[model samples]
Target: MQDKSKEAAILRSWHKNVEPWTRAVRESEIRSRVAVSDAAIVNAIIAQSPKHVLDLGCGEGWLVRALADLGVTAEGVDAVAGLIDRAQQRGGTFSVMSYEEFAAGAWQQAVDCVVCNFSLLGHQLVEDVLAAIATLINEKGRCVIQTLHPAYSGEPYCDGWREGSWQGFSEDFSDPAPWYFRTLATWLAMFKGCGLQLEELIEPLNAESGSPASIIFVLSGSSRK
Candidate 1:
């Protein structure tokens, strides 16, 4: 029941704060380092030419739309109803459902790839979510996850160069979401525990000032023994 309340709060927050800024932010970032990282992720999977792909926590379906434009059959899921409505209105097949509610067998025996862009970190039960993603992937399938750098996660930073104290905000400000700010080592271990092998790690140039920015992980699932 506590988890349910948390999830509900997250969904409400998304509707109130995050969904309103989704399109503009995504469009602007798409032309910046964020887009470069996204392209790198797509490139890694292009070699396999996956037939079915799932975009978890897909907001406004930007990445899903991009994948579809590239001719990949993609479906998206998000917990926020407003985001899902917008995504579907844009001709995308998206559902307002949490990863917890997703059925592995409903999609297929397995999915070729699962792309989680700036999502899934906030859940209190992150391990369960990761495990669910592992089950959703086909053997040797790919999983791409992108998240903000640790320095920005719950770190005190001055927003303005003028004289002012650095105010603190939650790391997962995007959705009023709850996040466990794991270090790089912790993230790697989480994936490994879910039976995924790290294939590539790309750090994007900071969109704010071109310094080293966010981290993206491209992982491949291991065959069941």
Candidate 2:
């Protein structure tokens, strides 16, 4: 287990830096080619028709807004108060809380779906987060994570910890938290150890570049051994 205090600190600093950068790119970020693949993730969640949903590290509440637009009860939580405040101002349901804090609480009402989008990176506590995700969902519930594809990310076939920064965007972005890169196999193993089963792994590719911009993992607890 990671030291909760230390994990919380890292989360806070990273998100504090990210809040403004994300705000600058809102809505426009979704139109990027890489973001087009996110549509697949959204489609998968909608197909599940979840009654209630939890979005971990939910930045700016775009996913929540989309889900609510479909009549699904959705709530978002982020460590950055700036992002949470903005989300509320935009008429989205949001809370200012880190994943560690959010996961430590008792969610008596387990949700049908939990989404962790691109925020579960560079942390040794990812396994712990996965365990927490298990407790957040009900039986037959699913957890979906959309993140950088291990194969095509950074160096080909590299599996190790590396500090990451905002890139492929404008010079305006800065100070990203570090990332612990893992191969697809490593990710699957972590899921299994956390008492979850990897149901599917989808890589969203860039049409022009012929490279995957991100990967989405669909996981389930019932399938765990």
Candidate 3:
């Protein structure tokens, strides 16, 4: 098990250390090249026709803004207050909250769908967040998770829980957070632990690089044991 206090401190550091990073993401267009699976995610959510959606760990609430175009009402929650504040400045309904608090029943609003995006980081935090989501959704709700491809992680490839400045996306930002790299099996198992069944999985390929840019999992609540 990972310490919530430690993860909370790390999250604050990430938000405190990266003001410009959040700004860039907040101002970025929906179709930015760095947006690995924004289109796919939005499409998937639209296809589901969810009335109310939840954006867990939604940094700056870009997805919340985009989802509005499809007429799907959404709210966002993040551990970083600065990020939440910035997201609110953009006319988004965001709350400054953490996974630990959420799992402990902080938020009472159950949603029709939940999207984790690429913000689900850390080993224990990931499982904790998934477990929280399980109790925060309606009976037929879905979970949309987009994360770095398992095939593109590891030694010499920047895998596991390591701390460093933001280097993969660009050299413009500076922030260090412990990112837990999990295998495909581990990710699927975590979803199962949350009482979610994998309905679909998509590997979004980068058009320019000709390789998978990220992995997206579409899941729904299940009673199967």
Candidate 4:
């Protein structure tokens, strides 16, 4: 399938599985998340010492809530209305906005940090969105992204589409969307193209397997220290 088609399927899958997704997150059903990735991403963000933060592709606003507890002013945005509704119900600033809309400059608010936690799953639009985010941060800002390590893709070690799955998830979840997998090199290149520099590359380990649970890219504007 085409990149755009796969991207569309991703959004559709999210829209269709909002309930189960929310339940899974709230209950901490995902083992990797419960074991490593969640705190990994959160700690990565806190290390940035951001005054204001934006959680792009923020699902049910869990990160926002977590950051708020630490006294950070954080706002969230997601494309799925159902997810946004659930997020708002829990109380925080969240809007239903697609990455395309964000790339088009829908939200005017700028922040010291921007985060994408396993939410970036597109191609051209992903590049465009990063470009847009580049302009929406302060000079001393950072953009942190945590995603599945490319080395664990179990496919050819190159950039391409891979079938997504709800394999470890409950039976209630369905409509898994195919995601565009990017190698570490591609990820670094994309960041550079967006005028961002890699400040750190973190591989959070999964205790059970002693393997990396996810890879976190800590990036900042070229001028940022």
- Candidate 2, residues 84-175, lDDT tens digits: the string is 77778879778877655655764445899998888786455678778888877778789988888887776657576665665655665565
Ten-residue region with minimum lDDT total, candidate 2: 27-36
What tens-digit string does per-residue lDDT give for candidate 3 at 7-120?
765776667655676756655633433556778778777777799999988878888999987687999988888888888888968898887788788888889899988777
Cα error, candidate 1, residue 198 (Å) = 1.2
**Residue 42's lDDT in candidate 4:** 93
**lDDT of candidate model 1 versus the reference:** 0.67
What's each prediction's TM-score? 0.76, 0.86, 0.87, 0.97
Which residue pairs does candidate 3 place in steric collision? none
Candidate 1 segments whose C-alpha is farther than 4 A from its true place: 1-8, 25-40, 44-48, 103-109, 151-175, 207-210
- Candidate number of the best lDDT: 4
- lDDT (Cα, 0-100) at 175 in candidate 4: 86
Identify the runs in model 3 with alpha carbons over 4 angstroms from their true place: 1-9, 27-35, 154-159, 168-172
The better-scoring model by TM-score among 2 and 4 is 4
Question: Model 3, residue 132: displacement in angstroms?
Answer: 1.8
Query: With candidate 2 superimposed using the best TM-score fit, by how many Å does residue 224's alpha carbon deviate from the native?
Result: 6.7
TM-score of 4: 0.97
Quantify all predictions' global Cα lDDT against the true fold. Answer: 0.67, 0.74, 0.76, 0.92
Of candidate 4, the 10-residue stretch with the lowest lDDT total is 152-161
